[model samples]
Target: MPSPEETVKLVQQSMAVYVKPREQAEHVRRVIAYHLQSTVEGSRPGGPLCLIDASANISEPYQGIRGATQEFFKASAANSKALEEFETVRKAHTQLNQPAGPVIKPNRYEILDDKLHLINQQEKSARLGTLERHIDILSEKPATNPDFLSLKPIFKDLRPLVKVPREIVDSLAMDENADRRDLASLVEKLDKVLLKSKLLLTREEQYLQTLKSQISLDPRSVTPSAKARALDTTRNELINWIESELSKASTNADDSDAGHDSDSSHGPSTSGEKPGEEDEVAKKTRQTIMTKLGTVKESYQLYVAARKSLVAALKEPVSMSARPVAEPPVRQPQESPATTEGSSGTASYLLLPYLSKLSELTAAQKAVIAYKSHFNVALAKQLKEACQIIDHLVPESQLLPQFPWPASERAKHLNPGSLDHLTAAVSDQPDLSSQIKPWVFASDSARIATMETVAESIEDGQVGIESINKTLTEIASLFGEVNGDSASISQGDPWADLALDLGLLGPKPRP
Candidate 1:
C-alpha cells in the first residue's frame, strides 16, 4: 500500500508520461474544475459529493493479476482511504475559494424595527406581569385599600384571557392576604404614568393648533374679493357722508344771514324818533346790514373750503386738498393830520381811561407805551432837524431857481404843510430831498437806543417802581418774549428802575 503522497505522485507521473500532454493538461483542468464545482454544490444543504469522490479514485487506480493484484487491491483500498482523506482536504481548499454569502450590510430601518419590536415585547411583558399581580391580589379577598380598588378593574378586564396561569388566578382570589398599603402604592404609580401620557397628548395638540394659527394670519389667507369689497364700502360711505354734511352747513349759514338782515331792518320801536329821523336811521341800518352780509359770505366760503379739506383727509383712500396761501393782513391807509386829530383823540379817550384804572399794567402794555412815546419824540426831533438842514442847504432865492415858478395863484400859495405843495415841490425838482432824505435822517442807531432805554427802564422800574416790581416776574419774562432781532437784555441783567416803578416788572424785595 502506498502513502497518500506517493499515490498522488503516481497519479501525476502516469498522467504526464502515458497520456498526451494536451490530454493530461485537459484532464487536470477537468479535475480542478470538477473539484471547484463540487465545492459549490456541496456547500448547499444535501448537495452531491460525486466530483470529490472521483478525484480520489484517480489518485489510487486499480492494478491487474489475480493473486498479486488482489493483494495490491487490498493495499489500494487502504491507499484509497488515505486518498479520500486528501480529497477531503482538497475539497476544503476549493470551498475556501468559493464566494461567500453577501457581505453583512447593516439595514438601518431593519435595526430600528427590531429595537421597536424588542421595546414593545418588554412593555407587553411588564404589563402582563402587572396584570398577573393584580389578579393574584383579587383572587384572595377584596382589599379595602384605595390602590387595590383601582387594580380591581385591570383584573376584571383580564378575566376573559383564559391563557392566564391558574396560580395567578388563585392568588388574586386570595388578595385580602396582601397588604392594603402595597396595593395603594401600586395604584398611585399607575396614576402618575397616566398623567404623563395625558401631558404628552396635550403638547402634541398644542403644536397642531400653533401651526393652524400661523396659517390664518398670513395675508394670502384672505380672499381677494373680501379685501376689495371692504375698500369699496369704506370709500363710498365717506364720500356720501361728506356731501350730506356740506349741504346742511350751507343751509344753516344762509338761514342765519337772512335772520340777521330781517332783525336789522325791523329796528326796536322807541318813542323818541322824529318824522324824518326814522327814515335816515333806517337807510343807515340797511347799508350796514349789506356790508355785514358781504363779510358773512366771505367767511362762509372759507368755512366751506375748510370742511371740504377735513372730509377729504378723513376718506379711506385719503386725499389732500390744495392749500391756499394765506393773504397778509391789509394795512389801512394813514389819515391826514386833520383826520388823525379826531381819530387819535377817540383812541386816546378809549385807551387812557382803561389804562388809568388798571391796578397793574402788563409788561406788554408798558413796553408798547414806552415804544410809542419814544418813537413819537424821536420822529418829531428828526423831522425838525431835517427841515432845518434843508433850509440851510438851500436858500429861498436858490430854491425858486432850482424849482419851477408857480403857474397859478393856487400853485404859488403851496405850503410845506400841504400835501399838494409837497407833491409840486418834489415834481419841480426831480432830485429834491427824496434823494438825500435817507442820509439826512438816520433812524437805525436812534431806534436801537430807544429800544434799549425802554427795555432797561422797564427792568429797573425807572418808570414806576411799586407797580413794575409788583409784576417783576412778568416783566423778566418779556426779555424772553422779545425775538432774536428785537432788543433783548442779557439773562441776568437787573430790571430798570423805571420799569420797576411803573409796576410793569414782577415783585421784588423792599428797598
Candidate 2:
C-alpha cells in the first residue's frame, strides 16, 4: 500500500541500521523479527519496511561474499503470495538508480527455526572471512613490519583453536578433551615461539643499527663483513627454528604428502594432531599460524636483504659524479585519418557498435521513464534488457557452456588432400576461409537470435498506440526540421537525426 518513494526510503532506513556486510543474516533476522512484531502491533516503522514489499517478503543475496551462510537463505516456495507483489518495491529502487539486490521468496525458517543461537553460523562465517582477509593482507607487499600489538586481536581469535568452548564442542561433536588439549598445547607453543621471534627481530634490528653507526663513526671499530655474517647467522637460526616449529604441524597419512608452505594460498597444509579429530577450528588455527609464520619469514628475508645491501655498500665506496643535463621530450606528430593505417588506428573503435546500441537503449529507457503509461512499456523494457544482454555477450566469452570439449572435438579434422583442395578452392572463393573456419564462439549468432525475438515481439505488440515501427518512425520524424532542412534537428532525437544524416532513413513526409 506504500508509495514507491516510501518503500525505497524504508528499505534504506532498515538496511542502514548499522549491519556489517557479513552480518546481513543477523540483519535479516532482525528485519523479519521487526516485521512480525510490527505486523502484529499494526505499527509500521520506516526502518524494517525498507526491504519489505507489498507482499512482505524479504530478499536475501549471499553469492560473491566470501563466508556467506547458505543455510540462512530464504526459500520462496514457503510463501507464494508474498513475492508476487515484491517487484513493485524493487522497481522503485531501480527508479532511484540503485540495485535492490535479489527479490527472493520468504522461507519458513523465520517461524520454524528456533535453534539460532546454538548454531553459530553467522558468527563463524564472519570470523572466517576476517581470518582469510588477514591472510590476504599479509600476502601483499607490506608497508611496515608485522607488529605484535596488531596481531594480538588475531591471537585472541585463534584461542578457540586451542580451547574449544564446552557449548561449541558439545554442539559440533569435537575431538576428545585429551586430544584437543594436546593440539592446543602444540598451537600454544608455536604462538610463544612466534612472540619470541618478534622480540628477537626487534633486538637484532637495534643491534644492526648500532653496528652500522659504530662502523660509520670509527671505520676500524667493526668489520662490516664480519657483522653482516653474524647478523645473517643469528637471523637464519631463528628463521630455521620458526620453520622447524611450523614443520611439526600434525599431518595425517592422507595429507602427509603435502608440502609446508609460507604462501597464504597454500595456508597451513597440515592440520592438528589426529586428522580424524581435526575440525574447522583446528584447520583455521593452522592457517592463521602459517600466515603469521609467513609474515615472520618475510620480515627476516627483508632484514637480511637490507643488511646485506648496506654491508655491500660499506665494502665498496663509490665516487660522486656530476649530474647529466636533461633533454626536452619530443612529441610525435598526430596521424591523419585520411592516411591508410591498415586497421591499427581503427581497432580502438571496436566498442563503437555497442556504444551505438547503448545510445538507442538509453533513449528507449528514457521514453519509458517519461511515459510510464506507454502502451508498449513492457515491450520496451524487454527490448531494453535484451539489448543490454546482447551487448555483454562479447566475442568468444559467451561460449555455449560445454564440458570436456577436448582437443580432438574442438579441432575440425580434414584430410591432407581435402585441405589442399579447399585451400586451392579458397583462391576461387575469397569467403571460403572464413566460412569453413575452425571452432570458435560466433559473435553474430546470439545478436541475430535476440533481434529475431524482438522483431516477433514488435510484430505482436498487443496493439500499440502506434505500432512499434510506427512509433520508431514517429520518433525518427521528430528530427526532421521545418521546410525539410536536415541542417537543424527539431525534436532532438539524436538516433533519428543520426539515421537521417547517415541516409539510412528516407525523407520525412510533408504535413
Please tell me which predicted candidate would have the highest TM-score against the true structure: 2
- Tell me the tens digit of each residue's lDDT in model 1 across 1-511: 4466886786676445334577875885566446555545645424422224323443344455344334434544655666665677678756765567866879999999999999999999999999999888887765755677685677775646458798887877866756667887798567544544554456568878988887757778887666664444443344345545755766786676667556545644433445466557656775786678557555544544454344444453634776565553232222122323444454555555665667355666567655655664466457557767766755533333434333563344445666656764633323334434433333444566689998998877755777666577466556444445646545555754225345576644244
By summed lDDT, the worst window of 10 consecutive residues in model 2 runs over 331-340
Q: Which sections of candidate 2 miss by over 4 Å?
A: 1-278, 321-511
1-511: candidate 2 lDDT, tens digit per residue: 5687987688777546443576886776676665556445765445642343335443545565332123223433223333453556567656776446876766778644645854677789999999999888887745445664486766775545577688987888855665444788798567545544554565568879998877756647778677765554454444445544644643331153233222222443553344333445556666786678667655645554554455445565566975454342232122211221333234324545775899999899667644543433454346556655544553444344332234553354344346645764533322333322322333345556689999889777755745775777666667553344535544655454344466676555333
Q: So what's the TM-score on candidate 1?
A: 0.13
**Clashes per candidate (backbone, < 3 Å):** 48, 2
> What are the Cα lDDT values of the candidates?
0.56, 0.52
Most lDDT-accurate candidate: 1
After superposition on all CA atoms, what RMSD does each candidate show versus the true structure? 52.1, 50.4
lDDT of 2: 0.52
lDDT accuracy of residue 341 in candidate 2: 38
